[model samples]
Target chain A: MSGSDRTASLSYDRTGDVRMSSSRVVSLIARREILTRLKDKGFIASSIFIIVLIMGSVVFQVLIQSGASNVTVGLTGAPQGLSAAIQEQADIFGLDAEVIEYDDESAARAAVQGEEIDAAVIDGNSVLVSESLDDTLGAAINGAVNGLALARRLVDEGVDPTILQPVSLDVTALQPAADDAEEVGEKALVAFVSILLLYTLLIFFGQFIAQGVVEEKASRVIEVLLAAVRPWQLLAGKIIGLGVLALAQLVLICAAGLGGAIAFDILTVPGAAIATVVQVLGWFLLGFTLVAALFAVCGALVSRQEDLQSVLLPMTLILVAALVLAITAGQNPDGSLARVTSFVPVLSTMVMPIRVATGSVAWWEIALSVALMVLAIVVVVRIGGRIYAGALLGKGGRVKIKDALAAERVS
Target chain B: MLEFDGLRKSYGANVVLDEVSFTVAPGQMYGFCGSNGAGKTTTMRIAMGLARADAGEVRWQQRPIDLEVRRRIGYMPEERGLYPKMPVAEQLEYFARLHGMNSAAARCSATDLLDGMGLGKRSKDALEKLSLGNQQRVQLAAALVSNPDVLILDEPFSGLDPTGVDALAANLAERRSRGVPVLFSSHQLDLVERLCDAVGILAGGTIVASGTVAQLREREANRQLRVVIPGSDGHWARELGYAHVDSAQDGVVLLQLDDPSRDQDVLSAAMAAGSVAQFGWRQPTLVEMFREAVAA
Candidate 1:
C-alpha cells in the first residue's frame, strides 16, 4: 500500500454504445421484480394451488351432475307401444331414464320392493314404488299411460284423433321470463367463482406490491435505485411487473377452471363462462392497478416490515369491503344496490364481475365501470407515485403522508 | 466536469446546505471533507439527484443534471445498500444495466469488476452471505460496474481495510486519469489529502474553504515554525513580539508567525539566544487544517 502503488490505478474500460431509454429503464426494473418473485417458492406454490383447486371443483361438479341425471324404472304387462311411449316422454323431458320390463306384475312389484328399480308401472295403469317414486320418473310414466289411454278411447269412439286438433295452452307472461332454477344456480356459481378469484388475486398482488416497496426502503436500496431513474419509473416498473405476474396467474386459473368444466360437461354454456373469464381478467387489471398504486405509497411510508400492517390496513379494509359487496352482488345481481355498486371504482372491480357473470349487466354498464376504474387508477397512480417518490428515502419509523408529499421529488 | 452550483437545502427550519458550490474538473479528484451533519451527504445526494436542492442545480459539462444525465453518474450512498438476497454478480449487473449498459456489457463489466475486487469466487453467492469486508467491496464494485462518467460516493472509504482502501484509491485514480470527475466524502482526512487533487472543507452548511491542498495551505494565515534552541527555554520566539508559541516540547518550540517575511528575523533571534539545533516551517496537515476550518 505504498504511495507509488496507489498511483498504479486500474483502467476502467468503457464497454458499450447503448444509452438507456426511459421505457427500457422501466422494463429493466420490471424484469428484476419479475425474476425475483418468480424465484419465490411461495408465489409459485400458491399459483399452482389455486389452479388445482379450480380443476378439482370442476371435477366434483361433474361427478355430482352425472349421478343426479341417471334414473331407472321397471315395467310389467305394458301395452303395445307403451315402452316406446315412456322412452319418448323421458327423452322430451331431458331425462336419462332406463325402462326395464318384468315378466309379470308380481315380479315388477318384487323388483320395486327390492329396490332393484326406482319404481314400477304395473299393467300400464298404476305405478308402484319402493317407498316414494322419483317425481321425474313418475311424471314420465304417467304421461306415457295417459297418452296411450286417450289414443285408445279416441279410436274406439270412431273419432279421428288427428282431425280433432290437439290443444295446448299458449302461455305468456307480461314480464320477462325468469331464469329457471338450474340456470339461476349456474349463474350464482359463476358469480361466486369469478368474484372470489378477483378478490383473492387483488389482495394477494396488492400486498406483494406493498412488501416490495418496503423491502427496497428497508434494505436502503431505494436511494441507489432513485439515483439512476425517476421515482415514478421505479414505481411503474413494480406495478407493471407484479401486475403482469398476477394477471398471468389469474388467466391460468381461469383457463384451468373453464377447460375442466367444458371437458367434463359441467358447464353447458361454454361461451358465457369464457366471457366471464375475460371480464374477470379485465376487471382484475383495473382493480389491481388501483390498489397497487396505493399499496406502493403506503409501503413507501414505512421503513420496516413490522410497520407495514398499520399502513396497509386502510387499503386492506377496502379490499375486504369489496369482497363482501361482491358476494352480496352475486346473490342479487339484478338488485339496484348491486346495479349501482357495480359502477363504483374499487367496488366495481369486484361487483361488476359478478354482475357480468350473472348476465345481468348491460354492455354500457360494464363499459362505464371499466372506464371509471381506469380513471381511478390514473388518479391514484399520479398521487401515489408522488408520495412514493417523496417518501422512499426517509429513514426510520413511518413517514407521514403530508411530509412525504411536501418533500422534494427524487428526480 | 461536474459542478454543484450554489446548492441550498433546508429541512423545516434547520438549514442543511447553504450556498454550497464546488466543481470537479475532468481528470480531477475532489475530496469532500466535513464533520458529522456537515451536509456532505446532502450535497452528494443532490448531485446524484437522489435529493433535490432547494435553490440550486447540479451541472455536468456545463448542463444541468437531469434523469438522463444522472444515469451516467455512479453513486454510492452513505448507507451501504444493495439487494441482500441477490447474488453478487447479478446485483452488479442490474446496477450496470440501470446505468445504461447493455445486457452483455453489463454482464462482462460485472465479471471484470468482481474479479478485480477479488470477489470473483463469491460472485454467485448472495450479498448477505459475504463477510462485511467483502460486502463493502461488492458495494464499491456496484458503483463502478457501469464505468460511470462521474462518481459521487458518500463515505466510500469509511469501513474499508487498508488494503481495500488502497485498491479503491487506485481504482478511483485510474478513473480520474481517464477524465472522470470523482467527488467522494470521507472522514479520513489524510486519505483525502493523499488522493484528491483538490479538496473542499465544508463547515456549517457551506464550503468554507476549497482548492488544492497547497492552495488551502497558502490561503491560511499564520505559518507555524518549529525552532530548537538548546538552552533558550522556548520563550525567545514569543519575546521577539512577532510570533506566538503554539507548543513547546523539550528544546523545540512551535511558533506561529504573524508574517511570513520575518522568518529570517526569528531565525537570527533564535541564533542569538543560543545554539540553533533545528529551524523549519511546519506545513499544516489536512487534519489540522480541517480542525481549524471547522473551529472557525
Candidate 2:
C-alpha cells in the first residue's frame, strides 16, 4: 500500500476512534455475557416471572376497574328525573351507586330510620333530603328538586315563574375539570406505570448484575475472564447488557399494558411524561449501576448461592428504603424526608415518584440529582471493578472489602 | 516460552517458594513433582499471574506477561471449579470465548472435546450432575478448548481415575506434539517419569532437584539391583555378599549396595551364579528417587 493510501485507510474521520474502540469492546464483551446468562434457566425463568408479574399488574388494574366499589346507599321519594340524573353521573364516575325508591315521605323516612341506604332524597310538602353522601351530589339533587318545587308553587300562586326564582349559586372547582373521560383515565395511568417502571427496573436488573459477578467467581470462570479483560469491562458489560434487557422488558410490558388500555378506552397517561421518561430511565440507570456494583462487591464476599441473602441485605434494604421513600413521597411529597431523599442518590430512585406525584420538580434538581448519581456510579464502577478483579482469582475464601480495594499488583 | 526468574513467595514467615526459577520452551512438557506443601502450586500460580510473588517476576517471551500472552496460556488450578448449574457444553464454550475464541469456534471446540471424551451425549447436562471423573475431563477440555500456547495445570492427575489419568496424559502429549509448552505439577512421580521431558523436584519449599528423567535417576549416587534364579536359598546372598535391600526365595535378593563405586562389584557378584537368569544394575524409578529426595 502507498503512504497516502495507508493514511487514507487508517482514517475514517471518526474523531473519537479510541472511544469507539473501547465501547465496541465493551459491547462485544457485554453481548457475550448477556447471551450466556440470558440462556440461564434462572434468568429466563425470572424474566418470564417478571413478565407475568407485569401482566398480572395489568390484570389487577383491569379487575379493580371492573369490580364494584365497597359502598352502599338508599334513596326515598326522589323525583324520577333527579334520581335518573344522579344515577347516570355516578355510573360515569366509576362509582357503584344503588338507588332504592320508596312509596311515601313517611315510608322513605322509615327506610332512612332503618339505615337501609346511605342516603335518601324525599320530596314532600317541605323538601326533605337525607345527607348521607357528599354534599355535591346531595346539593345537586336538592337544587334540581327545589327548583322544580318553586316553579310549581309559583304557578300555583299565579305568579310569573321567572320572577320568583331570581338567584342561584353555581359551585365549581377552583381548578379545571378534565374535558374528556379519557383524560381522567390518562391521569390515573401515569401514576401506576411510573411506579411499576421504578419497581421492575431496580429489582430485575439490580439482581442481574450482582448474580452475574458472583457466578463468575463461584465457578472459577472469572479467573479465566480476569486474564483477558479488566474487572470493570466485565462488570460494565454485565450491567449494560442485563440493564438493557430489563429496560427492554419494561418498554415492552408497559407498551402492551398502555396500548390495551387505550384500545379498550380504559385510562390514558399524558405524553408530556413520555419525554421525561428519559429522566426516570436516567434515575434507574444511576440507581441500578450503584446498587449493581455494590451488590457485586458484596457478592464476591460470599461463595454460595444460599449466602446471597445475607450479602444482599444492605442493597436490599437500601432498595426497600428507597422504594418506601418513593411510595411515601407519592403521598405528601413535600414532607421533610421526601424532600431530602429526592435529591440523594441513595434515595433518588424512590423519591422521583413523589416529585411526579405532587408536581414537576425543578429542572435543576433533576439535573443535580442525576449528575450526583452518575458520578456515584462512576466511582462504584472503578472501585467495584478493582475489588472484583482482585477477589476473582482467590479461592473459596471470602475476600475482605478492604483488601480487595487496596490494589497490590498480582504477580 | 514461559520463564520464571528468581521467584520468591511465602505464606507469612513460612517460605513456600524461595528464589525458584525455570524455563519452559515450546514443545517441552515440564513436570513439577514435589512432596506436599513444596510451593509448586505457588510458583505456577505466580507464573500465570494469578498470585503475587513477594519478589521476582514472570516473563513470557523475554518480557512481562501481558494480556495477549495470558490469552495463550491455559491454566487449571489444583482446586477445580466449574459452573454447577451451567450445561457442560455451554460451560466449556463460555470459557473458550473468554480466551478470544469466537462463539462458533468455542462451540465447535466444546462439542469436539465432549465427543472425544465420550461425553457427547451429556454435553447439555449440568456440570454438578456429572461424575467427578467426568468433571475432571471437562476441566481438562476447558483448558485445551482454547488451544493455548503455554499450559499450567496443578495436580491434573491427582483425583483422576486410571482412564481419566490416561486421558489427561494423552491430552498433554498431544499438546506437546502441537508445540505448546506445558508446565504441570503432581505427586504422581511415576506418571511424570513416563510423560515429562524434564522434571522439577520440589521439596521443603524449593527445587531440590530438577532434570530429565534419566538425569534425575543419574543424579542418584547408588544403584539398586534385583537378581532372581531357579535354585539356591535366600543365602545365595552368601554367594553375593553385598548390602541387600530385600531378599526372597529360591535365590532372589534386591541388592541395594548404594555405593556407586561398588556397582560393578555387585553386578559381577550377582552374575557369578552360573544359573543366574537375570542380573543388572538399575537406577531407581522416579517413585524411589522422589522418596530419597524427600528423605534427604
What are the per-residue Cα lDDT tens digits for candidate 1 across B201-265? 99999999999998998876447888987767787776878788888777899988778789899
Interface RMSD of 2: 13.2
Candidate 2, after superposition: displacement of residue A255 in Å?
1.7
Maximum-TM-score candidate: 1
**lDDT by residue (tens digit), candidate 2, A179-288:** 34354335435554656667666766676666766777777766555655666667677777877777777677767766665564355343643533545666666777
Which numbered prediction scores highest in lDDT against the true structure? 1
Model 1: what TM-score? Answer: 0.89
lDDT of 2 by residue, B61-180 (tens): 888886657767788876687777778998887777766676676677677777778888999998889998888888878887776778989888877888777766776776677677
Model 1 chain B worst lDDT run, 10 consecutive residues: B217-226
Clashing pairs in 1: none
Candidate 1 per-residue lDDT over residues A1-411, each given as its tens digit: 123232233345556637677789889999999998998888788778776776676678789887676677888888887888888788877787788999998998888888888878888888898778777777888898998888988888998878645577797878753665456566667667777777778778888899999989999988888888888889889989998898888887787777877787777777666766776777777888888898899999999999999999998998888888888887778998889888889999888888776646668887888888888888888888888888998888999999888888866
Q: What is the interface RMSD of candidate 1, in Å?
A: 3.7
For model 1, how big is the CA root-mean-square deviation?
A: 4.2
What is candidate 2's CAPRI-style docking category based on DockQ?
Answer: incorrect
Candidate 2 - chain A - TM: 0.71
